[model samples]
Target chain A: MRNVAIIWKKEIDSYFVSPVAYLLLTMFGLIFGFFFWNAVSYFVIIGIESQMRGGGGPMSVNEYVIRPLLSNVSVVGLFFIPMITMRLFAEEKRTGTIELLATSPIRDIEVILGKWLAALTLYGCMLLFTALNFSFLFRYGNPDWKPLAVGYLGLLLQAGGLLAVGTLISTMTRNQIIAGAATFGVCLLLWVLEWVSGYETATWAVVLSYCSVITHFESFAKGVIDSKDLVFYVSLIFLGLFLTSRSMESLRWRA
Target chain B: MITVEGLTKRYARHVAVNNISFSVEKGQIVGFLGPNGAGKTTTMRILTCFLPPTAGKATVAGFDVLEQPMEVKRRIGYLPETPPVYPEMEVAEYLRFVGKLKGLSGANLGHRVDEVSNRCAVADVKHKLIGKLSKGYRQRVGLAQAIIHNPDVLILDEPTAGLDPKQINETRDLIKSLAGDHTIILSTHILPEVEQTCEQVIIISQGRVVATDSVQNLQSGTRGAETIRVEVSGRDGSIEAGAVRQKLEQVAGVSRVVLRESSPQLAVLEVESLKGKVVRGDIARAVVQAGWNLNELHTAAHTLEEIFLQLTGAQPTLEAPASGEKQ
Candidate 1:
């Protein structure tokens, strides 16, 4: 655990020293801020329309604003997660510094976890920026905070899972661009797998839909924390990191 | 100390390191001399636990590299062929990261980092980003990282490969200074470098151990079959260069004679005697008998370069293989 922290700290330092971290932050902030403005303005316009009609009670901000905003942020994250995890192992291999890591006394698990945790922390920072924007809703209206907390937890778990997979992909190649492209492709496939459910009712389609990351995030976005969803995210995270450690072991053999 | 027993590393259809074995005693600097693709780096990688041997065992500091890789890694510091440095990191920060990874912490880490930085002559650029440093400085920083924790063994793969002559000399001096405290295995194709720094050399060829010996012994052993060069001035016009060469080639004990250089006033011939024959006296007597002024006649001791070329090329021709040669 201590060795993991050392690697984690160095990785984080590497991220900030390079322009990639700032580039991802600015890009995520802009995309999420745009989504937030659109979601809030749409919520306010609908609130005004319903109030003028005088038919329904005041609209629930939880449903109208916070929920959709969280889901939209999740979608935006698919694009940024690749950027966060692209350089984790690929850059090390490209620069020949992978030799140092592999030959160090630290365990392969520590290296993988430390790098994955660094990516998750950077992703967490991007989430924090979006959360600051969501804090505006609390000043004027009483939106339930518990759902937002649960929603953020879901975002983190979902990011953790995808980032772990990205870490595995990063270890497969020394080219960061290739790692990024492959991660984006895999994330997109997972995101769109749920669409198969609309056209087919077969067991395969059900399994595909169940495998889609969106299927797991949906319950969390709606203020529900199903143990099934938690298990899915945790299992995916473990599988990804497990594959990364295996890849690291093979790298030593093949080097 | 390090030990290897029939350490072999095969990749698919080709073997990178054959069943080669050798050992290094504590506080000794052994040079791994080989051509570019002769598997020196591969062997070093295996010893450092960066790679595993395909079908053999290697132990470092009494720990098997395969079974106790972490233990071996803890005792050895490896600098690969290219300096493995993160370009985005400052020198001090990069050293700190490597030091921490080696399990040093707190004040000890700081003190060790400072010690290696100063020792490596990289302290002036400690705060400078590594990407902006020159290749010499980067190589020095790489050396600094390797010694930050003061491991028992240091595996340096061509540590002076890309440095200027001045930096190369300085680096050699620093390595020499660390001789008694650290066991170093430096690999290089440059013969003079091994002569300058390494006490013993392990000459590798085609993934096999071809020769190993102390520098002095290797040199003196090759002396038995040394080449002799003779320059003669044939009284300005008493004989043509061809006649001078013909006369010299007739000398007994001379196996092969080649005309090295020829002028109207002078001609130089290099004579190679058969193994175990000293042809110097025979050549001088023959030159004097031929009525040619023997301007110069001296036996040229076989340099490591000739021995290296002969060993690493298609032929393994050393009469007495060094003590480390397995076969």
Candidate 2:
């Protein structure tokens, strides 16, 4: 546990000391802020239209504003998560510091957990930055806080699952660009996998939708915490990290 | 302490380290000498647990490298051919991270960092980023990181490769100072470096161990024949170069005499003595009795360079580099 913390600390320090962390923060903040502005304006326009009609009840802020914004945040992550996780191992390999880590006394699991946790923490920070815009909805209108909390939990689980896959891809090459591109490709595939079920109800389509990361996240986004969804995210995280450990073992054999 | 038996590493097309075996005793400084592509780095990597051997067994500090790698890693410090450094990190920060990674903590880690930086003469650049430092300073930082934890065994590949002469001398002195406390295996192609710092040398060529012995023993054992250089001057050009070479060849115990230089007033010749013979005195007497004024006469001791070339089957006196090129 101490070894994991030590490695985690160094990785976090490296992120902050370089320009990458700041670049990622700035880009994520601006993009998410744009989505936030659009969602609120659209909600306000719809609320006024209903009031002008003088026929319908008040629009739920949770439905019109927070839910859309949260879902949009997940979409933005498709672009940003790759950036955060690309350098986890690729940069170490490129700089030759992987040699030091490989020959150190620490276990391979500790190294993987340490780096993955650091990447997750950075992603958490980006999520927190988006929450700044969401606070406006709670202050101006009455929205249930429980569902908002659930939505954020969903984001965390979803990001954790994707970041694990990103970590595995990072170990495949020493080039950060290649790692980033390959990770985005895989994440996009996972996101769009549910589209196959829209066309038909065949067994292959059902299985494909079951594998989609978005399918598991939708329940959490709707203020529900189903055990099946939770299991899917956790399982993806485990599979990704397990494969990463295996890849690390191969490095010892092929180095 | 280290031991290896039938250690081999084969790449896709070629064998890097063939079935070669050698051992280093506790507190001994051994030199790993080899030409380029001779598998010095490959062998060091295997011992350091950076890579597993394709076929064989090896142990470090009494722990089998293949079986108990974590134990082996805990007891050994390794510096690869290229100094492994993060260019963006400051020297102090980098050393601190490596110290923590090696399981040093609290005041002990801080004290050892200071100690190794001082020992390697990198304290002045501890705050500087590694990428901005000169090659010599980078090499020193690499050395400092390796010794921060002060493991039982230190494996360094081409440690003095890119340093200036002054830094090279300082590194040699520092390594010599570390002899009795740490078992070190350092690899290099420079002959004099081994003579100056290492007590024993394991010379590998063509991915095989050609010879393994102490410096003195290898030298004496390979001194099969002797060469006596004699510089003779004449009184008003009395002796011709051809006549002098002919006469020196006729001397007992002398096998071949080759004239190195011929001038009107002076001549220099190298006389090769027969196997296991001391012919310097014989050549000196022959020159004096022949009425040739002998200005200088000395038998050149066989050098490690010649021994290395002969053992590696390189040209006897190669003008090409022995092993300094990149593999």
Candidate 3:
């Protein structure tokens, strides 16, 4: 237990001590900021029609800002969450420090949990930075708090699911570059399922896509906390963490 | 104390260490001598619980390595050839982390960190990042980390391998100081290191125990060959070489006589004997009385280097590695 906390503290220290974490944070902030501004400005002046035909469009700023945020956050999240998790075990293995940790008195599960918790903590901080976008809505427009809160919950759950998938991919290799690419590939593949048409196939795909992280998060974005959605994210986290622990054990023996 | 029995480690095709076993009593500083790929590291790893033996048993401080590895790990301090250190951490912080991992906490952790730093002479570089330190200082830091918890056994693999002459001398002195309190298994290909610090030597080659005994015992083990190296000065004159050979052969246990060299003037005799007593004293007395100049008479026993070469089949003399590449 004490060793787990020691490892956790060291991992969190590694996150902030390097430039990579800050760079990713700044990039995420900029993307969120740009989309928030564009969403609000598009409908704030007069509606969308004036620029095209001098006839006003029906969508209001709330429709513009809130609609894009619900979807765009999911898209933005797909990229951001993986970047945060790419180095978890992969970089440690690459550096040979993983061997030190494994051979220590600490158990394999402790190492997996400590690192996973650190990655999740960093992702949560990244998600918090996205809240600044909603701040703009609160100040300039009268945004409905319930829907926005629900959206935030969904984003939180989605982040949890994406973080798990990212960690699983990182467990596969010692190369941080390969881990990053693999995590992105998995996230991209799942996120793209939403584009496929036909309600029957897309519905099942959407349901699976609800397992897809971004899809389940979409439900909360419109103001609902589905227990099924919560359970799916929790189960994915458990599965990912369990596989990570097993990988650590296998690698330890092999070494 | 450590006890090992039938320790055999095999890879898929070849055995790295085969049925090799030795025991170290408390306070014994045993040096492991072997050539490269002689299974020195593999055997050490097995004893340290870093690798499991294919079929055998090992116990450190009475805790079976297989059944209680954590207990073994707790009692052993290992420094691999590369010294597992974080390049980013300062020497002090790294030691502190290691101490903490080894179960030292609070003021005890601080005290141990200080103690090890001073013992290893790494106090000056305690605040310097390990990557920025020189090879010698890095080695000291590595040693510091290993001994921070004051383990009962210190397994240092070539601890002085890449050090300069000054650092090598200092590290050797440090190890010598550490001897009685900690049972140490210091491995190296360097023979004199065994002579300097270790009371007993265990030489492993090609995964087999080629030799294991005190330094003096190893030298004297090849005493069966009854050849006494004798140097005599004789010109064209009075003394018969055959007469000296015949008289020396008459000694009890003196077996056969083979005179060495084409130079008749420089008569060197190699006496083969079943040999009761060494008989060199008697032979020397007789040779002098016979009117032959007895220049020198020395009992020929194997030197440590010769024994090492003969037993392990390794080169007796290897060129010292050029300075910069030693690192």
Candidate 4:
């Protein structure tokens, strides 16, 4: 556990010391800010229209503003997660520092976890920046905070799953650009797996839709915490991390 | 402190380290001498737990590298051919992180970080980012990181590879000072480094150990016959080089005599004697009887370079033309 913390601290320090962390944070902030502005303005315009009509019920900010904003956060995460996790193992292998980590007393699991956790933490920080934009809703409106919190939890779990996948991909290669591009490709594929559900009801299509991460995140976005959704994200996280450890083990033999 | 038997590492097609075996006693600096791609680094990697041998076993500090790698890693500090350092990290931060990974913490970690930084002469650059430092400083930081935990065995691959002459000497002194507390295996192709710092030399060639012995023993034992250099001049200020070579060749037990250099006034020749023969006295007597002024006469012991070349079967590029056929 202590060794994990040591590696975690070193990895986090490296991320911030380089331009990667800042570039990621700034880009995420700008993109999410744009999405937040469009969502809130469109929600306000719809509220005004309904109020002028004097017939529709009060609009729920949770449904109208927060859900789409949180959903967009996940979409933004598809891009940012790769950036956060790309350099975790790839850079170390390229720079020869993996030799130091491999020869150290720490177990391979510790190093893997430390790096994955650091990526998660950096992603968490990006999510926190979006929280600043969400705070505006609480200050001016009577939106329920519970659903917003659940939405954030769902976003984190989803990001955790994707980051684990990124971590595994990072271990497979020493080139960060290749890792990043491949992670984006895999994430995009996972995101689009649900498209087949709209066209057909075949069992394989159902299974593919079930494997899509958005299917599990839908309940969390609506403030419904399903045990199956939690299990899906947790299992995905476990599978990705387990495969990462396996990849790390094989590296010693292949190196 | 370390032992290996029949250790071998095979890639997909080629063998990196062939069936090789050696051991190191506690508190001794053993020089792993080899040319490039000679499997020195491969052997060290196996011992350091960075890679497993394809066959056989290795133990460090009584811990098997294959069965108990965590225990083995706990006792070994390794510096690869390229120092395993993160360029983004500060020197002190990198050392502290490595110390923590090696199971040092609290005040002890801080103290050791300071000690190793000072010991490696990298204290002045502790706050400098490793990427910004010069190559010499970065190499020192790598050395400092390796010794931060003071493990039982230190495996350094080419510790002084990129340093200038002054830094090389300082690094050598530091390595020498590290003896008796840490058993170190440093691999290099530089023969003089082994002569200066290592107590034992293991010369590997083409994935196999060719010779393992002390520097002096390797120098003296490689050649079966003894050689002596004799320089003489005619008493009358001129000498026949061919006739002098003929006279020295006639001396008892003298197997071969080649004129190394000749001028009208002085002639220098190297005389090789048969095994177990003392031809120096007879050669001196022969020169005096011939009324030639013998200016200089001394035995020339085989250098490490010649022994390495002979053991590795490399062509001796520095051998004189006349003695080239003797090989």
Candidate 5:
């Protein structure tokens, strides 16, 4: 456990010491800020229309403004998660520092968990930027904070799953660009897997949609803490980390 | 402190380390000498637990590298051919992180970090980022990181590969100072490095151990047959190369003579005497009796370079009977 913390600290230091962490934070803030503005303005325009119609129905800010904003945040994560996890293992391998880690007294699991947690932490920081935008709703409106918290929980779990996958892919190659591109490719595929459910009700199609991460995240977005959704995201994290451990084991032999 | 028996690593296409076996006693500095692609790095990698041997076994500090790798890793400090450093990290911060990884903490980690920094002469650059430092400094930082934990065994691969002459001397002194406290095995293709630093030399060639002995033993062991070079000039200001070669060959105990250089004023002949023969006096007398001034008479001892080449079979020496007969 101590070794894991040591690796975690080193990895975090690497991210911040370089321009990568600041660059990622700035890009994510700009893109998500635009999405938040678009969502808020559209919600305001709709609220005005309903007011012009004599307050047709007390519009719920939770449903109208925050839900779509959180969902768009997940989409933005499809791009940012790769950037966060791309260099976790790839850079070490490229710079020959993997030799030090591999030959150290620390176990392989400690190294992998340490690096994965650092990526998750960086992603968590990126998510914090979204909270600043969400704080505006709480200041002015009577939106329920419970569902907002659940939505944030859902975003973290989903990013955890995707970042775990990115961590596994990062171990597969030494080039950070290849790792980033491949992680994006895999994340996009997972995202689009649910499209088949719209056209086909075949059992395979159902299973494919069931495997889609978006399917599991829907309940969290609606403030419903379903056990199955939690199980899905947690299971995805476990599988990704387990495979990463196996990949790391194989490296000792192949290297 | 280290034992490897028939440790072989077979890649998909070729064998990196063939069936090789050697051992190092505690507190002994062994030099792994080989040319490029000679499996020196491969062997060190296996010992460091960075790679497991495909066959056979290795043990370090009584821990099997295959069965109890954690124990083995705990006792070994490795400096790979390329220093495994994170370029963006400050030197002190990187050493602390490595110390933490090596199972040190609290005040002990800090003290060791400071000690190793001073020991490796990297204290001046402790605050500098490793990437911004020069190559020699980076190499020293690498050395410092390896010794930060002060493991029982230190495995250094090409420790002075890219340094200037002064840095190389300092690094050599540091490595020598590290002996008797830590058993170290450093690999290099430089022969004189082995002669100057290592107590034992393991000459490897083509994935095999060609010779393993002390530096002095390997050199003196090849001194069985003596060789002397005699440069002579005629009293009349010119010497005949053929006449000098013929006269030197006739000297007692002189087995063969080859004319090395000839000019209008001098003739240099290399005289190879029979095994364990004292022919220097005979060759000098023969030159003087033939009315030629003996300009130079010196016995050429077999150097480590010749022994290494002879053992590795990289090149046949000029005096080898087989090559001589072929010529």
Candidate 6:
């Protein structure tokens, strides 16, 4: 555990020192802020907020403002997750530092956990910046605090799962460009599977959607907390880390 | 102390390291000598617990590399062929990270980081980012990381592989200074480096242990040891060289007798005796007693290059078993 913390601390500092982290976080914040503003304007400009007084629509200002914030975060996630995860192990292998770490007394699993925690820490910071929308909920409009808190919970789990999965892909290659491609590909597959299973007529696809990042996030994103959904994301985080450890074990011999 | 027995590492159809066995006792600096691709790095990796052998066992400080890898890792410091470095971190930060991973903390970790930095001569660049440092400094930082924990066994694979001559000499001296307290196993194909830096040499060839001995023993065995050469001639063929050798064998301290290469009539022989046994006077008397004329005697000199070539490349010269013809 200390080794993991040591690795995490160094990695976090390294990320901040590099320009890449700052650039990605800045871009993610802008995109998220835009999504929330769009949701506010959509309800007001379409006269939907006013017309839904009798209809079963988002009549409250809180639903109009907060649901928009959570509604499109899942989509915005498609662009944001890969940036935080691209450098987990691929860069280490390319620079030859992987040998230094692998030969250390620390176990392979510990290294994986350390790297995942590092990336997730950055992702967690990125999610924290979205708090602006939450504050706006209580300020300029009515807000359903329950769904908003649940939305943030779903966002954290979705980000954790994607980070773990993306890190596993990063371990499979040395080129950052290739790691980015593979990470983006896997995240896209999981996200798209959610749509195919839940939105389309495929029953088995829907079953697999349980593994999709969205399936677990949907109920929680709407202010509903479910243990099974949390389990699915936690299992993913563990499974991704497990595969990463195995990849490193094989790589030790190859190197 | 470290022992590797029948260490074999195969990659699919090709064997990177074949069955090889050797040991390094406590406080001894052993040099692993071999040409490129001779499994010098592979063997070091196995001992460092970085890679498990395909079929063999290795122990470091009494811990099995396969069964107790972490224990083996804790006891050994390894420098790979290429220095593993994180470019963005400063030298001090990098060393601190390695020290912490080695289970060092607080004042002890701080002291170790400082100690290794000063030892590797990386103190000046402690605050500079490793990526911005020179290649030599990077190598030193790598050495710093390896020794930060003050491990019992230090495994350096090609420590001077790509250094300038001046840097090589400095690194050599640094490694030499480490011999008394650290059990070091360093590998390099540079012949003279092993001759100068190590007391014992283990030469690996084609993934096998070709020779293991003290530097002096290996030198003497592969290339004939330095010995006095004697030339002799008979005035009237009064006595044969064989007669002279029989008499010489009876002398107080003569050990070996052989015919000379200059001429068949002239006998050149090397006389080895127990330490402190002087046979020069006895040899002269024996030659005179056998009636053989002695012309010249001088100790033969052979360089280490010849010895290394013979030890590393001594394949069986195929010839007709009964034929006496020279190929």
List TM-scores for all candidates, in order: 0.88, 0.91, 0.82, 0.93, 0.89, 0.85
Q: Any runs in candidate 3 off by more than 4 Å, and if so which?
A: A43-67, A136-157, A193-211, B12-14, B222-305, B313-327
Candidate 4 regions exceeding 4 Å error are B233-267, B276-294, B315-327
Scored by CA lDDT, what does every candidate get?
0.89, 0.88, 0.77, 0.89, 0.89, 0.80
Task: Chain A TM-score per model, please list them.
Answer: 0.99, 0.97, 0.85, 0.98, 0.98, 0.90
**Cα deviation of B298, candidate 1, in Å:** 7.6
Q: Write candidate 1's Cα lDDT for B1-327 as tens digits.
A: 999889999998799899999999999999999876788989999899888888888999999988998899999888886788988889999999999999999999999999999999999999999999998999999998888889999999888887778989999999899888999999887888988999999999889999988887787576466578888887656547898778777888878888889878888888888877777887888888888898898877677887787767755333331112210
Candidate 6 lDDT, B1-327, residue by residue in tens: 899899999987789899999988999989998776788888988898888899998999999999999998898888987789888998999899889988899999999999989999999999999999877788888888989999999999888866777888889899999888999999887778888899999988889998898987776555333355677778675346676666766776555666555345566666665444656666776776666787776655344556666767754332221223110
Q: Positional deviation of A129 in candidate 3, in angstroms?
A: 2.8
Kindly list the per-residue Cα lDDT of model 5 for residues B1-327, writing each as its tens digit: 999999999999999999999999999999998877889999999999889999989999999999999999999999998899988989999999999999999999999999999999999989999999998899999999999989999999989887788888999999999999999999988777889999999999889999999887787567567788888998999778898888877888988898889998998888888987898988888888889999899977678788988888896322321111110
Quality of model 4 by C-alpha lDDT: 0.89
Name the runs in model 1 displaced over 4 angstroms: B223-299, B315-327
> Mind giving the per-residue lDDT tens digits that candidate 3 earns over B117-207?
9999999888988889998898888888878888899898888888888888899899989888899999887777788778889988888
How much native contact recovery, as a fraction, does model 2 achieve? 0.75
Arrange candidates by TM-score, descending: 4, 2, 5, 1, 6, 3
Taking the tens digit of each residue's C-alpha lDDT, what string does model 5 give over A1-255? 888888888888888989999999999999989998998899999999989988687889999888888888887899888999999999999989999999999999999999999999998899899999888988888899898899889989999999999999999999999999999999999899999999999999999998888878888888888999899999999999999999999998888
Q: Residue B186, candidate 6: how far off, in angstroms?
A: 0.4
Native contacts recovered, each model: 0.98, 0.75, 0.19, 0.96, 0.96, 0.81
Compared with the real two-chain complex, what DockQ does model 4 have?
0.86
**A1-255: candidate 2 lDDT, tens digit per residue:** 999998889888888889988999999999988888898899888888888888788788888888878888887887888998999999888877888898889998999999999998988889888778888877788989898899899899889999999999999899999999999999999999999998889999999999998878777878899999999988999999999999999987776
